[model samples]
Target chain A: MSSGYVPGLEGIVASQTAISMVDGENGRLVYQGYVIADLAEQMSFEEVAFLLWEGRLPNRSELDALSLELANHRTLTQAANITLDALPTDTDPMDVLRSVVSVQGVEHRLGKPSVPLAIHATASFPTILARFHRRQSGLDPIQPRADLGHAANYLYMMNGKESSPEVVRALNTYLVLLADHGMNASTFTARVIASTESDLISSLVGAIGALKGPAHGGAPAAVIEQLELIGTADNAERWMRDARKRKVKFMGFGHRVYRVYDPRAKILKEMCRRMNPKFYELATKVEEVALQILHEEHPERPQSTNVEFYSAGVLQAIGLPKGYFTPTFASARVAGWSAHVLEQAAHNRIIRPQSEYIGPEPRKPIPLAERV
Target chain B: MAEFSPGLEGVVAAETAVSEVDGANGRLIYRGGYLIEDLVPVVSFEEAAYLLWHGELPNESQLDALREQMATARTLNKSARGTLMAMDAATEPMDVLRTVVSAQGASKSLTKPSLDEAIALTAVFPTIVGAARRRGQGKAIVEPRADLGHAANLLWMMHGEEPAPEKVHLVDTYLVLLADHGLNASTFAARVVASTGSDLTSCVVGAIAALKGPAHGGATLAARNMLDKIGSAEDAEKWLREAHARHERFSGFGHRVYRTYDPRAKILREMAKTAAPDLHRTAARTEEVALAILHEAHPERPNATNVDFWASVVLTGAGIPKELFTTVFATSRVSGWTAHVLESLADLRIIRPASRWVGPEPGKKPLQLTKR
Candidate 1:
């Protein structure tokens, strides 16, 4: 009965590949028809990306080509670097990403009559990430290396050094975890923009802006801070208790989608173990303490650990600074976001919903002087 | 020349009888006499929503009608379910809502009354959020309970089981706290959409896009990140100093609207006091340290703690995970968004803003020597 549609029937279907599937009854997740568990364990982030776009696993040659292409595009343009350098250092990373993506659109001259969506994303993603890292590190952007892998090249540009296998693996896992989720805010924004038949860069810019919201891609690093507050297990219960008293929300626990467990949590937990055994132990202890307290306090709510819980641990164990958690999330999520934009574009339609107006009814004009 | 509504700086304050913003004094009074805390203690979310919409307390029958209407609207269509199921499991839940709501416009019956349809349209919002989340977890969707109140049903649907009465009440209070604010960005966007006489879904979709911005509903997640970065109280000062030095905008501190203190912070702080006593102490200390540092650093910007600062504490204490903070915000805000949309429909007008065109007025050939 609201302005848009009958409550149950709106925006329910579209023609697109299922980027991810949520089986609410069983608490499971799958991406691009592949079980999340399988992808997290077996496939590289680049491979997962290919799967999302190509609709199947890539052969070795195809994957190698895609990797080379992605790596080649990792370098930012001179104009892009200039634009990023001109931005204020205090700018939120999301805003930075948005601005850079917009500029990329201009610099790449994406407005050219006909450009493929894949080419746009492929060219834009690396440039966006590289420029973002450059700005964050107070350095000028680097040129993309055609010889490196996507993960290796991104790390190279980000840190100005070749990444270790462990680091690349960690980054790859992070990317895989962040790659996609169903109809999230940023993806929706991308889809909305795409519905308008906006170019990929514009859609990506919108998506980046949407991702900046705290509710979306910004909670993983906060989980690490929560753990630090708990410190040793001795202080965990007390700290959690105190936190509960103040009503502070613990990072990385409950999720909107997963009532029982976040599948990504399991994957990240393993990744953390592989990265740093000590931090993994500490993280597990923190989780235990938080869970124990939650169970005792409000057992009825079904609060449990979600992706961010372990993601914080995994990223931290891998030696990434906490500030970069969100940016890293952006890097991985770019694939899924681009994919969703493409999907929306494939069946392009403007996304415009209605509203339920609840303000003072239109009134007769009141004299400005008489209106106290 | 296009007419501009100048000198209408604070006129909206008098027009919408929602909340009185004493920007200079740092106070927000909802309705005529009710302080935020006063309402927080006794008012249910449904009651608060009615007050915002009708500008008075709803009678029992009116309340019942609203409840029934919301209940009836809670069921999501199969198409929406499929769409949600198709999303990446790791994608942010709010993004999913934004996309679904935007796409929802296409499925509506435009011939129907916008308000009546909007009410029904928005009713299913909680279900969409709950269902999408559950589906991501691979859990079966729970059917909405006709007998339960709005908050109670939402919790039940989210968890796929019944919630304890106390938990229900807690969620209800949380929702009440989030129900509405003045014309914040997202609500303004909703109004913009409604002004065009578009459907409710479009308004809500636009509002969701706005809410996805970090400066808006995303603050809760950012606040959690700040807490995470600080780890323990001992680390707070150092972290704050570094962050400030780095020019990172602290999430939970400062506000665009409230010059002194966010009133919602007070209410949530009290609630945290009752629910999680231990977290309360840490949160209090955190607040103290943050306030001291903020006061010392930026004496000019009235760096009063806002709703997000305490809301994060309360929700964290209540054992809700950090990732859910923004989702919770969305849940509470949906009511306000719907109310604003309904308000916009009362006097239909297109919200088309004109820009000051500084370019040459009409097409003109360049003065070339050869041409001359």
Candidate 2:
């Protein structure tokens, strides 16, 4: 009645969510029926998060309330703080989030997924990253500022002073753009965990793990690294061709969805061009050559620039260390992940897929003493 | 395009030689094509773990090498230790396992998943689980014993006494049996994380989060709790009948795979008689009634007792606390999780499945925050 094998589950539909949709043929992303283009520059991460959770944009009062709620929960739990301190100063921020979030989310036992828990978990991510970033840099960790909005507060905590409005707005748009992305691997991981009727933290924790992979959220850092190695626009062709010979993948160049340019990447690329001209110049040339070479190799495939490519330049402009790239991605995506978790929890089915076992036929076992 | 299959049921998401659950025939074949039944008596858990990673049965020297490798990696890293201490001892051990594993695997930078990292990750689990168990009892955390093998050391750390050979054999067999199964949810979660080119710890942490779901690794704990609720062999029929009348799904009675009896369950069912004889008697009767009731309701359903049904008893016999059952499952399954990650590295592709949009049509504009 069903197909046997679908490698990479290419065309399989694993979920049905009203949270977001990837209109791959049209190169659009929609959050609750609003095109990302309309929402990205206009919304704060908190309002978009509310839209994702409640299926509508929050009114001024509702937005204010939601912002306050997020602000209130931004500080880490004492145990979580202790756990954060326990980690090595040099530990990856993603790993710190994974562990500290677990400690922060620990309950006496399992509880059903809920909205408050999601909000709490989302708020903690920036704090965890900022604290660890400070610890790594040997700077004193700044307390979260309640007066600041989500993006501003994260900056304040990281730099110990409020950032300019432009930087905060840039980050806000970045978060809004990256907030949700249809049924991605990390979001699917969240849904899979939630489908088991597990707690929200469990789902969030699982999604974070999925995002840690370079194939998923790990590429933004690599994009910066690749650019650093290439040095300048003049070197793009030679460096990229040499990398191809060595089988060094061009990071952030492919997407399974999106026939045209990624909508998010289009927005990020603009921000990158304005904010980081040096990175933008080299990245643009690399993108041109890569697409041309890729097209020559496989004319049928739609291998275009993804969000991670220009995301490197924008994040670098915003002054996050390269190491924090994926973790920062997680901070934005946690909204999507939590929303997905809640969505899955509402009409849950245990997402246990069947495996076609291609192994030996059963036989009796020999005692160990008699084995060869 | 394939139609949406809820749960991705019957979707063969992967191809592998790690292990196979030949559900129709009730067989489990581990890597190297060794049948579960055949391998159980012939190999120790350590040897089986070696096989999963190396694709061959380890000879004595290899087994010893693996044992030595595991022993050296058994102690928790400073971060992991601090994280465990930071948690409330009364918190769910799975939460602790997830958090501490994340901490233990935390690094300054992301490293690709590797066999050495796998062994280190696997070795650290018993230490965390053992510590969590001790802390739960208001007892001091016990250190792992180098002289003890994996299963034996787990017991020694938990109880501060040498485990009996029979108990060790039962635990080891349980571990070996669960070492891998083709593309189960948790393993799929791990592979999905790895697909992102994430590190081994992140992959394993994700798997652990997925496993926390009640429908997956938590089944053993749920199965045991059900047995405790039913109380005794004499109470089995009445308890199950009432629970069935109320339409409550029995915890360990049904599986997605295994058209017949589960091979692991069958072996554990027999082992239960000698392992936890009293609980085994109760479980055996409970299984009989549950299966009968299940068959009567859905004549064509496989309706078989799964490994968790018997695993609960065996784990109990092995002196594992119920809270630690899921953590114990992680200890066994981490080897499988890491192995799948390593194998997938050879053919890494982002597992971003399509989602059929069920939301409102796009192109809606948002109102200003004040206007809204």
Candidate 3:
């Protein structure tokens, strides 16, 4: 047997399904057998969520029911509220989400025999987002309105006011774009935790913890910081030159899976254009400058704008606070985190990776008094 | 069968006044003497930080010296400042922290030299974070004031002016509450990295990265979000009912280690009493309602509130924005991260774990795909 199986296929089923696919070689992403572009443009976040969860677009009644369910669960429990109020204001939103999700496990349903826990995750996700916003803003959380769709209601609850159509569309697109990626670290973590037969909250918490790592969920915010440094288009080249000199990895340019282009970037680019043409123009210029420098530095590596680069511009245009960019990403990716956790549970197996041993050989233990 | 443990098992031997973790029970005790709650209420953030780093409460002389050292370290290197300024403003603060931290090792010497080296290293972190924050805000980084105390200087750098005594005191309390918490995942991770004989900066960098995980340091953001959703105490019970029905996890009300209570929660509860009295009352009432519901609904788990729950309330009452919750956690926990790293370095053993072989056995012949 090979020492390392690059493509881990120990128990992967051969059956084809309409969930998602990662084309690493070509750097493409597709959801439910549809290209990300198609879905981001034609569908809402709720529609994509239903597609991922139910394997197809929801029918009108199913969609409405799902939306109402999501909306109804938007507010947090009193205990959760107290907890939310207790956190340091400066805590990272990702960490906050992680803790919040773990607490959910306390009340999670564990002994069900029929429907898997992922369904419960789907039902609970909107509430998680709602509660997160409420605690951070120091505002009393808004109860979800049953009449509203999930995407629309999330914005309403977030701002404690009605959302504009444009804002809702932008947020919906962001959610769709981030709903899933390939088996990234957090997804792997979720699968690992799920394999232990631990509860879904534990799995989700594991995923959240994984996502909180700087190498993973910290990208969107990094992209924003990169753009700010470039300042005007005039300084873009100089900034790129200096960044390369310092060997700093431009936050939004590279991807582990997408070698050529992040398809989500394309969709977000479109969203930015729709949101504010001027800001979109500046964003495009920023991307052009970054791509140009990347091409010059390493032509072999595909370095194009990823979702984070476009996400920065899109979020800024929509009036999201600069600090909240990553938090917003968390809000959207919770669905993906939930989905991966459920998938891991369905075919539970512990995820324990081997390491190349490079250490001193085992020796006789010394007495503790002599160790110092 | 060789007994295998997936996680590392060993000893870390650095002397620290920071936090202690009881992994078996999931309790985190901060400092040599005080419980996390006691410190949070009675101590200023600066005093807590001093206690964690020095292994005792700072007397008047020690406090003055430490404050001066921290203030002096607040100044950012030109290169580091430029780098921070260059980052995309929309970048996640955590990501910015990571990048800056990774770069900081080269920019400054954070190694353990004499007593001076350790003090210098400890002092530089607030400067790093403060400078990064300023650069992100499109403001020039402030030089630390030698005249002020640590907490006061940090506030000065952050807000570009000296803060009121009350504001400084509030920030100091926050620092104390967050300074250390036993051997949590991030702290353990830091120890693991340090065990490899890596430098202090690398170990701290790893710890920060680990702590960024939602399950560990991210709960504050989740708590904030939950608070945002409920809007007012009047809607708390209804929100709880729906959240329960949906099976969504709530933030801050449960913990992995503490079955009865999280010690930090009590500290924060008290802080909230003085800082935001109205919010504190509401939060306390909310906790009562949540506990009642959980007792009846989830008899098996019977989860209770933890530190994040009350911390969120205290911070929100202090007028901190929700998005910054995790950032605040990062600031306070650096002392713990540093202590663990130093301990790991002192012990000087690589942390390697064994895994149960679940993949194809080494001697197994490869099966042909066509045959399958």
Candidate 4:
């Protein structure tokens, strides 16, 4: 007998993962045994990426090797460059990232998912977004500096100059916090593709597509848009009340997995307070009003503020355009996507789940010309 | 925590009317309650696609409108063209497809998936596949003719000549047979992406990436390669015996869903006799020997031939090169992928399944980097 259909597979355990765990009940995210709260501010994005790919923290030499490898692969391939230019100057940055990454990883033959391929993919995401951003602004693309760290190079490539230390650290912290989480939609998409034995780039490309959805990584940019519409902290309650009356969704207010406040949101909220007081002022007011309204509407639901809520402010403070929010999320999550691909490859199984057919019984068809 | 389903094997993730694989009874049913066998003789690939998308077989005028719509949408947009030209001729066709399709669908803003977009995406697969083929052969790319039907246009673009009527019939039948099949891995990938409220192009692109895997769409090419190695009917037994002794799994002999002969495989096997007589003879004999050897080894299993086995011969007869088999498979399955995505929109919910954490305990503190 088949199991009954579970809509959205909500709470279904699909895999056993050692790479990361989202402890939703406890509001904790753990990567390879270390709590996210402990690692968020201290670790470089490169170290978190390594920890995701390999199931342990890399030693100093190993970290240096990964950093160097990632830096070396920061430039786009010739094909990727042409493909990047092929898109219109006004195309969405996420679309540009998905398309160029597909071209950058094109191969003559199928290659198994490997750590080197993971590094290659993780390195290219920022470059693709930065190049497209520059092109959109009618500026020449900047070359990536190998001497800079992963987060620093991405900033350098986008602005054509090195960012201050505080800004680089904030971007690096954002990347580290978002590098991996257990069985999210985009990660699930990546693992699903990899379950079919597809290569890492294919998996990552598919993940990027899934992340572009409004329900997932796409929410962060919308959060920024909503705050801009709210205008000032003084008008937050009135605007939000009217928007709710019109059945408009409060972006970044809810999540399905986290029963409590998202741990990443907690960290990013503090970052916003320190780095972007202007955005933080309005965003905090919006968050407070949105939460109060939601609670009044559904008191049964637990308090929820997802990672995307404060992520908008942190990314804005780091000087990224709002359009680049989802693609930048892809840049961080590619490390986790590739790690999941390798794990799925190691424990190979074709993930062809059953579907309950609700169609009619089979019947004969009429001839084309004889139909009434 | 729920029990872990390694591959979600028996999990019912969705309820769909798009198509069904009743493996228990060996029946294949498409939308509108039409058996695949019943629909094949009376309809073209365009009609089958229309049925899948609109949930009914199109009437004469509706079919004509669909054909016109498809014909007009066959040409690649400028971005897609430039992206296609950017890739080397030696790149894999599937990689070309994944990239070009992404470029083709890149837009200024995210749009909801729609029927018009679905039809356009399905219509353009041949253009990308044909250009990839011509580029691989160092030949001039051929423009699609509006007068030709879907199957004929695909053949015409690939070969730079009008396709024979019989070959068109064979290809059309193949397309109809493969247009939809239950919750297949690639279709599931498409649905998973779509469930996040992503665009149709992203869903189709994700599906193409999954289909490139050897275990899914790539099985057809692998089947043809295996047959080529066996060479003739006389060598079937010896080659199979040696392979079985060496513990090599036969390329196209097993499937996860079917307990009996695949209905589509039965249809393709019959068509292969008329399409490629000599190869058909060799395939028939090889099938007999492979089945016996498999039965001897695993007497309890239902080791019947899959659709890929006979599809390889029929496609070969239709003059499709082995290298493009997977891409050709994507061409047929895009309709199904888009159909599934559209169906999922009525009750869209993010498919974020949970994962069991099997890593280290959560409270481990990290030592300073220099101490390591």
Candidate 1 chain A least-lDDT 10 residues: A1-10
lDDT of 2: 0.87
Q: TM per model?
A: 0.51, 0.96, 0.51, 0.99
Residue A69 displacement in candidate 4 (angstroms)? 0.7
Could you say which candidate leads in TM-score?
4
Candidate 1 TM-score to native: 0.51
* Model 3 chain A: ten consecutive residues of lowest lDDT: A1-10
Q: Model 2: residues >4 Å from true position, as ranges?
A: A241-247, A357-372
Off by over 4 Å in 4: none
Displacement of the residue B173 alpha carbon in candidate 4, Å: 0.6
Query: For each prediction, how big is the interface RMSD?
Result: 20.2, 1.8, 15.6, 0.9
Expressed as tens digits, the lDDT of each residue in A263-372 for candidate 3 is 78877888778886766776788788778888887888877777788888888876766656755666666666566555544544333232222222222322223322
Per-residue C-alpha lDDT of model 1 across residues B201-246, encoded as one tens digit per residue: 5456556655654556777777877787677666777777788789
C-alpha lDDT (0 to 100) for residue A298 of candidate 1: 82
Q: CA RMSD for every model?
A: 25.8, 1.9, 16.8, 0.9
Q: Which rank order by DockQ, best down to worst?
A: 4, 2, 3, 1
Candidate 1: segments with Cα more than 4 A from true spot: A1-17, A107-116, A119-141, B1-372
**Tens-digit lDDT string for candidate 3 (B252-317):** 776544556665676677778888776676677678778888888778874888778888887776
Docking class of 1: incorrect
Q: State the weakest 10-residue window (summed lDDT) of model 3 chain B.
A: B354-363
Residue pairs that clash (backbone atoms under 3 angstroms), model 4 = none
The number of residue pairs in model 4 that clash at the backbone is: 0
